[model samples]
Target: MAGHATVPSSPEPSSLRALPPSAKLVVKTLEYEGRLTQAELVESTRLPDRTVRYALRELEDEDLVTSRISFADARQRVYSLTTAES
Candidate 1:
């Protein structure tokens, strides 16, 4: 009699699936530009205000981005990548 060998299932890769293309672009922009206002992100990304806002929110949730009120303009908020992220 022959016995079958048991096989273990492999776990999915976590780092492999990161931010989408647009989100990745947003992260890179923030990483290179330091801190940028919403308008600045729109200009740099050429994306609509709503789209930028959504992307920013997602990045924030991932701890890859952060925002704060601008000293120059309290009405405007500046966004930047987290120090922990590369």
Candidate 2:
């Protein structure tokens, strides 16, 4: 460990830190509002639907976000952060 640098207990934060700005905004929105549908995320974040979709995909790829069928509407999916951190 002579030349080793310190590391965070969880790698998700660092992984999140490397994500695109749009993805970060989506994460922030979820953190503040908890779970929300794609449309709700767009309305809350004020990001375009396509951008939100892309960001959600990015977050999902990194395992930072999870989505499930919305109970209110099966056509939509509710999204939330996988961890406490963004």
Candidate 3:
């Protein structure tokens, strides 16, 4: 411990801030649209299907978004935010 240099602790931004632009857009879309299917996200966000899918995967990895089998279509999943930012 004596040889180690001490670094000052700084207040870091929310985990949300560290997300990629696509992920942020996906989060915002979910915030306004509530739960939506992947296809719906593509329509709402105007992002490519592959881009939307990647964004959703990133969101899920961060535990910022959650998904479940859609009631309307079991083959598709509806995604929503798991946490609210103050």
Point to the candidate with the largest lDDT: 2
**lDDT (Cα, tens digit) per residue for candidate 1, span 17-82:** 575667777776775666789899999999988888888888788766778899999999988767
Ranking by lDDT: 2, 3, 1
Query: How do all models score by TM-score?
Result: 0.74, 0.81, 0.79
Candidates 2 and 3 compared by lDDT, better number = 2
Candidate 2 per-residue lDDT over residues 1-86, each given as its tens digit: 78653332333567888888999999888876778999999999999999999999998998888899999999999998887434
Superposed Cα deviation of residue 14, candidate 1 (Å):
5.4
- Residue 11 in model 2: lDDT: 31
Ranking by TM-score: 2, 3, 1
Candidate 3 structure quality by residue, lDDT tens digits, 1-86: 79643432221238778778998898878876677899999999999999999999998888788899999999999988775422
RMSD to the true structure for each prediction, in A, is 14.7, 9.3, 13.0
Task: Show how many residue pairs clash in every candidate, following the order shown.
Answer: 0, 0, 0
Residue 19 Cα positional deviation in candidate 1, in Å, after optimal superposition: 2.4
